[model samples]
Target: MSSEIEELRKEIENIDKQLIELLSKRLKIAAKIGEIKSKVGRDITDEKREQKVREYWYTYARNTGIPDSLVDNILPILFSYSKMVQINPGKKKNITIIGYGGMARSLASLFSLVGHNVVITGRNKEKAERLASEFRFVYMDLDSALNWGEYIILALSPSSMDYIIKISPKFSNKVVMDIFSSKNEVFSQLEKLSEIYSFNYISTHPLFGPLLYPVGERIVLIPSKSTKNLEEIITFWRECGLNTTVSSVEEHEKAMAIVQVLAHFYILGLDRSVEILKKEFKIENLSDFFTTNFREINKIIEKVNNILPVILEIQKSNPYAYKVREIGVNELQKIRKELGE
Candidate 1:
């Protein structure tokens, strides 16, 4: 039995080796295709092609009796890495990030991964140096980083507007962007600052949370009064493997009202209600009875709990917040009435 187990392990090791070789060959082909795309001025990502590939994987998985769950889990990682290999940032820019927080680290990781020069700078030199070392990026003082960077990203929160105001003059002639989730107030403030500082302000909101190596995520770009070189900015984000959407400030606020405000509000209520009911009903060992759907929801609840402050800020800042919340409450009431609760 032990001898048979050893043989099986050896066979698995051999398969792993073949898998590595095939992945390497696939990436090499992707790199060559990237070169062709660069020469022809085509974008790196082809959504249609990706969809076809996903269908092929699903069909093959079904044929081989492989679980759909496995394909679902693995395909995104494969797609991300494939796009990573195909990224050809033709003229890498020096990007300076103005905060050393999670979002800053995420952007630094992506810029460094795609061969762009990134500098981490903030008031806290120690934190900046630590984050820079994680990606082998440069750690510079705020002023030096601003001067050195061709593009500047303000990764700080809306509450830090005073700090932003103080440094506004240093942004003269620079292309500056922000990654604020709620843009109603922040966008207007930044737009006004751009006019006074003589800088090009392009508002941006990264759709994904602050996860390292957030390849293939979507980022919304809103061109402000001083925005120039819009096309160049789009290409820069695409080269970093992010899908870009250009939106107006009003449109962005409305969308976030539904996407972030309403959804997070519902989840926050659900999280609190679940705990109250769990205790009220004296339920215990709930994990043992968790269905797949409940488990998925629990994960979302966990994520929301982790970022409560950001969630609350979005809830407060969206222009349509009050109306959206009223609608949400009414819907909940309707559901309760239907259930005779």
Candidate 2:
């Protein structure tokens, strides 16, 4: 090893240690601020303060000739952690998640981070255990989970929801919620089952991807007739650092038809168009020519491709899907006509 290289490595290690110490100091101060906010009955997240800090970071980067990307990438995560430390859900509850998929992990991360006792359970005990291990939570069988949990989250696919009916009195009188993307028929079915089984049923759609600890994300809540404590549920989520929007079943479904059905349908069409064009042009290395817009679009296409089954399911089940697709086709035809094609 060269002496110069070893000296540079030692310098890097010292810088890394300093960085860690600085971050720790910052978080400790943030935690103290959180304590003050709690005493005054203030919300954990102050958007104005975050924006002011972000603006200062950008100015500092500009003056110091540092790249904007460095600050942009790190600041959001830093802010999320700061807010996570600030959140103190005074009354924590037992949350049972009924799947081991991405959404299950996302919710479990948030709930467990805020001191909620979380139990991961599903038909596949191994998968449940694996997810539970990631969050330092325990895995239990469905019967035990239902009995142990105060708030039960149905995090499985819509197709797998029938499994809920298999368990009887276990879910009785519990606060049960389903986290389905589209709630056309499944929500109603779950509501009926809740009635039959005597459970409090609420339908919810998390308006974000499967990112862990989805802090500052929005969740749509559609409380059914059995969900008498809607405000309490909303308060619980707000306390956990999530913004909640309450809506009727019909309103929620209508918004999703446009948000999910129309958006995914167009993105699917765009994906196919890109693939066919790529082959026709014999462009084997598409990334070599990717512009900023193309890169962003490709990212969305990749996400859609990974979740094609869920996308297709939403397309099929959403009642306004056909109408949205028809409008999309008509718009495309108008564009082609404009180009004299």
Candidate 3:
């Protein structure tokens, strides 16, 4: 039995070494992929290819008895190193972030972590002065010190994006981009300045809550028009450890309506439903019949506890959110009348 155990251990060690060697070889291929994409200036992430990879993983998981969820989360991190192997081998670029708030600070740290300079800007003299005390070369405004940038990141609110793009006066030679999650309004506004610089803009929506994520998060980039240059920039973000998908403006906005809008409405409805449930006779007077009942209630309460702030966001940004709420109210009113409300 001892000799058998020793043989099994030796086999496991050899398999582990082989796995590492294969991963390293795959990354070498990934670096080559990066070079080709970078040279042609094509976006690194192909959603179709990603979908195929995901399908393969699930199929393999079923065969190997591994849970899909566990593999899903680690999928990005494992594949992301290939992206780093690709982009990190080249010259690091300076990325300018125009805002001093949460998004700006987050991007600054992210870019800095990857050995890129993060220059920040805001027109507010007081805020800029405070920001300048830091290391990312804070400027009072764009006009004062605008040029000498490679990739300019617009990290302001959605509404503020249009105002900055049209009036900024200095984006003529830069690869200007924004990270707004919804793109209908912003993309349409960019068309007004289409002649300012042909295809010099792209809008992106990071499919993540700002503070809750790191790199390898799904980032949907809505290119103004898919061009060679825009593709290279996509590669750049992917190399920075983000999974990116390019979309038409309509596709992005419609998707957000479903993703953010529907989700927000669902949570809001759930909270309202739970509140009504709490007023029920059982909740007001718990008994032996409520063993698991209290536990379920507590779980829902926890969900709503974190949902209030998200409700605020949905009410403000998602256009489809209010409509859905209106639908729900209308249906409830119909039910009430049927029951003689």
Model 3, runs deviating above 4 Å: 1-89, 125-140, 197-199, 225-228, 275-341
- Could you give candidate 1's per-residue lDDT for residues 93-187 as a string of tens digits? 99999998888988888898789988999999999999989999989999899999999999999999999999999999999999999888888
Q: Which clashing pairs does model 3 show?
A: none
* lDDT for position 291 in model 3: 56
State the lDDT of candidate 3 residue by residue for 13-101, as single tens digits: 99999999999898899879877876665555566777798899899998999998788786887776765666542468867677776
Which has the better lDDT: candidate 2, or candidate 3? Answer: 2
Model 2 TM-score, 2 decimals: 0.86
Instruction: Estimate candidate 1's RMSD in Å.
Output: 2.0
In terms of lDDT, which candidate is stronger, 1 or 3? 1
Provide TM-scores for the models: 0.93, 0.86, 0.61
Q: How accurate is candidate 3 locally (lDDT)?
A: 0.66
For TM-score, the strongest prediction is: 1
**Residue by residue across 94-150, what tens digits does model 2's lDDT show?**
999999988898998898778889999988989999999998999998888989999
The lDDT of each candidate is: 0.90, 0.86, 0.66
lDDT of 2 at 211: 80
Alpha carbon lDDT at 51, candidate 3 = 78
Task: After the best TM-score superposition of candidate 2, give how far the Cα of residue 265 lies from its true spot, in angstroms.
Answer: 1.5
For model 2, the superposed segments whose C-alpha errors exceed 4 Å read 1-22, 32-53, 335-341
